[model samples]
Target: MWISLVYLCLYWAFFLLLGLLLVVFLAYCAYVKYIHMKYDHIPGPPRDSFILGHSSFVVKASDNYKVMHDLFLRWAEEYGPVYRTNFLHHVLLTCTSPDSIKEYLMSPTCPKDPYAYNRLFYLFGKRFLGKGLLTNPDHNQWYKQRRIMDPAFSHKYLMEMIGVFNERAEQLMEQLAEKADGKQQVSLHAAINRVTLDVITKVAFGLELGLVEGNKTAFPNAISLVLKGMIDYMKNPFMEYMPKHWSFIRQVQESADLLRKTGRKCIMQRKQAMLNGEELPKDILTKILQCAEQENGLDDEIMLDNFITFFIAGQETTANQLSFTVMELTRQPEITRRLRAELDEVIGFKRDISFDDIANLTYMTQVLKESLRIYPPAPGTSRYIKDDDVIEGIRIPGGVSVNLNTYIMGRMDKFFPDPFKFDPERFHPSAPKPYYCYFPFALGPRSCLGQVFSQLEAKVVLGKLLQRFEFELVPGQSYEIMDTGTLRPRDGVVCTLRPRETASQ
Candidate 1:
């Protein structure tokens, strides 16, 4: 009788466990149902698959989806400026309306999306841009660093760097001169990339990378590898774990380490020099070191973060912008002629383009603005909503990622008529200002600190090229965009240059 009771008790225990599991499963189903119903009222494209959702459609765009900006552009047209898309369980709402953009980006309550920025925090199990001004999602921490770094990018300081800018831009012209005979096709993007790379290294840390003169440097190649790794990680975050990608992942990690190690060495040298009472040049590094000393060892990692930050930001974005500008100029001869006329009147074959000259080249300024509108280098920014919000009468649920894509917004016919046409008049001084619709360098307090600095460098480089040489696009070269971290000309702006007859005369 006792043995029979034991068996009965065991049977009851098993049934009770089964009943508990059923309750848990039903509860989970109800929660998921609630989530679907919450966003069901919102308009969006149907999920392309149950597993990948609309992200499958986006990733499937493959080559054309280079930067993913094209995907956003297509969806914006289909679902209007504001629509929701999903990547797995995460809901991403893209907004192109000026008012909506201003509200979310400018609000203190909204922070940079942790999910998006966290990807940049590490690259293949290595510290990449940890707590840098760009990737730091913590608003208070970012604000503090921004305050400390502000003086380095001040108007007076940037004006002082014009000599260095001209020096580097002139070196690029010398290199281009060899290829300007019109027979050899030149990759303007490659050449400009070197110059901008050299310029940032020299002006920021007072180190001459000598990349413009065609000297091979580890830093340049390392940066390239890191960028490639960034694109790969963005496409597949689990790439590092895959057997096929191990080699590439290892290379990226080594490159990131090389960058940080080099930065640490430079910081040590600079610190030692300060202790030795050596007179230091007033460069960005000098200013950063000063701020670091004040923090009393607290800002060591922060210092390294900014070091990488300035190098990448100061070079790649500006080079790509200049490359896109050249592509546009080659396509539009009438605009080039007008731009050349303005360059002649203001610069007049001057070897050294000054800060004041940048202001005087009004038409060139407009041309640059228009180029950015059509081909934004960085493309977009994102914010994480902490609370449910209403945007254009559509309710955006809390915890969803909101993307403000300048590339998509810039291409919209509602914001810019004949949007694909490269027109400088849209940015003419007398023309209406593009309130929140056009933000190549982004908008508000968190906007690029290097905006003015970059424009100054671009004007110097492009103006000198305009004054020295006339370039034509090589036939049969594709003008596709390549989104490797930043968008660049896929064919690297292949061109054959001939010295302008007017300049020769």
Candidate 2:
């Protein structure tokens, strides 16, 4: 009788637990239904599944290696400027309207979407870019750091960086000269990546990585792996838990740890140097340390956050932009000729490009602007809508992620006629400025702090390359863009470089 009673009790307990789970599932379903109803007014492509929503489309596209931005662009073209897409219960409202961009991104109140930015705080169960300026969802915390770090990118500070820029760029030119045989295929993207990594390490943290000199460091590969992990996590948040992906997840976590470890080591060295009465340059590291000191002893984790943040931000995007520019120059000989002429007239074979020379490279500036328009490395930004707002006659309900995409906007026919054309004339001085539509570095109070610094570095590197080498795209290479958290050329912009006739003149 006791054994029977025990069996009965176990059976009852199992059913009771099952009933509770059913109730919770129903509640979640109801919540999801309400969310769906809330966004019902917004038009998007037909949902592929009730549970998955547009995630199926994303997965399919990602599986085929399709550029996600291009997919978003297609949707924008089909569904008008203001439309919505669903990722499970999460509704993403994509706005390409210049007015909406001005209203939402410019406003100080609209904070970064916590769902999006918070995910970046970790990569596959490991800390990555935690509470950094880029990933910090809290506006007040971000502002404090931003305010303190502003001096690092000031005009005077940037001018001081020009010499470093030239020196590093010159190193790149020399490296390229060895490979400028016009037969040896070279990856400009890889070369530029090394130079940019070297520049940021030296200029920002006072560490000379000598990446351009073929110094073996895990940083480049580690950063790449971490970025890949970020994209993978975004595509499928549960990937880390999956048994099949454990290997990749392990590598990503190790990479994130490596980066943070490096940052910790660097910070400790700098702190020790300070204690030893050694003077440090007023670089980004100094500003970061000062910010930490001022914030009632902000922890080293936060400082490391900014350290890793600057490493990725200060290097990756700029290198991609330069690579894309070079790829375009190879395809458009006429445009390249015009750019080389501008370099000749302004710089005239001068090895060290002055800050004043950078200003006078108006044509080159236009070219760079055009490159950014076509291929912004960090394509878009997202904002969390706290209050309901009307955009383009459609009401955007609060508590959704609103995406403002430069890649989609810059390619739209309504924004730029002949949007696919590689014409620098669109950015010529006489041309009408593209109001809020041309924000490659974003816009408003929270815009990128490294915009000027990045452009300066690009000019020095690109100006020297154009002055010295005549590069041709290697045959049979696709010009497709790869979306690896950041957009870069899929083909790595391989080319054969020949010394310009007047290169030594």
Candidate 3:
């Protein structure tokens, strides 16, 4: 019995690898025939290996996804603005030119590449995200959804959401005050995560976990498991397919299922309370749910996907942006003081900072914009070409994924006058460049669903914090960003905060 079991296991392992070998051979043959021979005009890297293509180069780069961006930059330098690279024999073409981005992102022909972006399904799950607007490849559905949902960002609804924004910002200030009461090295890594997560819950679900009260969370383990599952599936297999029944895939599906179940319960509970004639709080979450209910009540899967997407999108990106902005401001006191002076002018201590006050925060918004430019949370955006296309006179064959790297784009001297300098003044309304040239949230129809939400949260959070706190970088500490699930600081951001006492006058 033992010998038979061992033999069975060995046979399965042999067959699994053999099957992979066969798939690579077929894909390679098709590549050589259709891509290399037929579309020889495309510029790409020299073949690295039989199966991996440039996969090793990608994995070996210090910043995992940034590798492709770096390579694209080098090739663009050599081959021109548009270039292609073979990622695990799956061809990928990249673009960085502002003109190129405008042409493609706005064009009807270029669709999001599912093969390149299918890795996202692990986080949002197959069922919930199967056809949701963000991940869906179907242009018609995206157009329809965008039409229906885009109005949520209209000025009136966005203004209605500001009260929750201010409330969350106020709560964050109180928490920051408590943390700085000790004046020790406080890990902003922890603080920002708590604030953003709380903001997402309150704004996206009409639920408040009140996370900062304690370190414990009911969903932390499950969320971590989901993210881990995403990395495992996307990395280990690469473009080489993995079995659908793989353990990590199963875990990701299960965790998304759990988050969805809880989210649905919360949504239903809110609806039931409304049925009981209870007044739901006025906020983005309430508005979103009301919109969902009014759209004849979408399928629960889509509802859950949007909720999870909002939580992740609405949470991590804003938090990281704030954290990095704080990190930069603390290090540069000159810039911070300029920022504070501007803030004082725009937001007087005569009363609490109101929505109207936030509008006049021109420099603060510039500071936030520069930070996002420096360390964009989602550094790269991707698309798949379904038909052969030419850009800059280079033929890009179909079935290729293209990653446009905003991080590298920010670094390019062409994009900004002094690329590496953190000059918020560059964002002054009088700045030389056009608005379409800079896209922290992508421009055009398929841009970030929560652009307004993100901007409001950042402005409110940073404005409130700066109003109350004098932040300075602690000496002997250097902050470098790491490419985590989001672009996060490699080490914790440590800053000393002294309360800005307003009553002395």
Give the top-scoring candidate (lDDT).
2
Give me the overall lDDT of model 3.
Answer: 0.70
User: Model 2, poorest ten-residue lDDT window?
Assistant: 290-299
Per residue, candidate 2 scores C-alpha lDDT tens digits across 322-400 of 9999988888989999988899999997889999999999999999999999999989999988889898898888888
TM-score of 1: 0.92
Q: Higher lDDT: candidate 2 or 3?
A: 2
Pairs that clash in candidate 1? none
Best by TM-score: 2
List runs of model 3 lying over 4 Å from the truth. Answer: 1-33, 62-75, 123-128, 220-225, 238-254, 271-278, 292-294, 434-437, 501-505
lDDT of each: 0.85, 0.89, 0.70
Instruction: Give the local distance difference test score of model 1.
Output: 0.85
The digit string of per-residue lDDT tens for model 1 on 313-417 reads: 889999999999998888898999998899999989689998888889899999999999999999999989888888888877787788899999899998999
Give the C-alpha lDDT of model 2: 0.89
Residue-wise C-alpha lDDT for candidate 3, range 177-237, written one tens digit per residue? 8766436667776677777787778766667677766657756555656655555456564
RMSD each, Å: 4.1, 1.8, 4.8
Q: After superposition, how far is residue 376 of candidate 1 from its true place, in Å?
A: 0.2
